[model samples]
Target: MILDRQLLLSNAQALTTGTVFSTNTIDLASARDIGIGDNLELFIRVIAPLTGGTSVQFAYVTSANADLSSPSIIVQTPPVPAASLVAGSEWLRVQVPALSDTTSRQRYIGVQYTINGTFTVGTVTAGLTLDREGLAVYPSGLNTAGF
Candidate 1:
């Protein structure tokens, strides 16, 4: 099953085009059974032509209800030296082990990017999917039917 999904930059610009951000969230009401040994995977695409920035920086935050009480984790992807965005886009895959044994009803994933020194918009279109047996979180591909 899928657990989460998001698109940080839609109209992705070049390293010199400034910064942009977007996000999405997914509910875990159906994923209460997910526990330890399971992992979280994310696929991100930075649209093309990032401009006006020394580099693109992606940041991630995990929470339970968009509240401060929710446990949060941060992850970041630095910029590449290529500077041309040869692929037109890039993908990010992440995994979070069962840090805690809690079965949650909702898990929030936040994402943002900075261009040189400024932060992008906010989390939009970010989502989470379910991974029941931990089988779907492997190296294969995303469980598309989820979330």
Candidate 2:
């Protein structure tokens, strides 16, 4: 899959303790539409195994400031086990929040990593995509993609 730099959040970033902001933040100061049947999505994958951490989470946040000094979380992925943080593991494949009021949204759009505990090693890459790959997921994990 081709990743767009503009929409990319983290690019194989090795994260430790604390929060890690995206290399690039989307600026939405003007009115814009994501288009019908489309949603801004995040694709986060692990490039290295994580150790010394209890768990980690991925979140979609919006802020009035470019530095995301104070972020308002729109959505987030479930906290995955630290042991599950292995190379080639996909952390999150989720849709952006369904927003109708642009005026109510913040001026900046970005992502953040909130580590639960101390982490000596962790790496991940994330990006946004408007095009969804295919039919996937079940309401209750019946079977991964089971109907």
Question: Which predicted model would earn the best lDDT?
Answer: 2
**lDDT per residue, candidate 1, 36-83, as tens digits?**
344544445444443334556665555576441343446667764335
- Give TM-scores for every candidate, taking all chains together and pairing residue i with residue i: 0.45, 0.76
- Those runs of model 2 whose alpha carbons end farther than 4 Å from true positions after fitting are 30-37, 102-104, 133-147
44-144 in candidate 2: lDDT tens per residue?
88888888898888888888888877888877888877888888787568877665676538888887888888889778888888766555666783566
Per-residue error for 65 in candidate 2, Å, reads 1.1
Worst 10 residues of 1 by lDDT: 119-128
Position 96, candidate 2: lDDT = 72
Tell me the whole-model lDDT of each prediction, alpha carbons only. Answer: 0.43, 0.77
- lDDT at 134 for candidate 2? 58
lDDT of 1: 0.43
Separately for all candidates shown, the number of backbone clashes (residues 3 or more apart, or on different chains) is 33, 0
lDDT of 1 at 90: 44
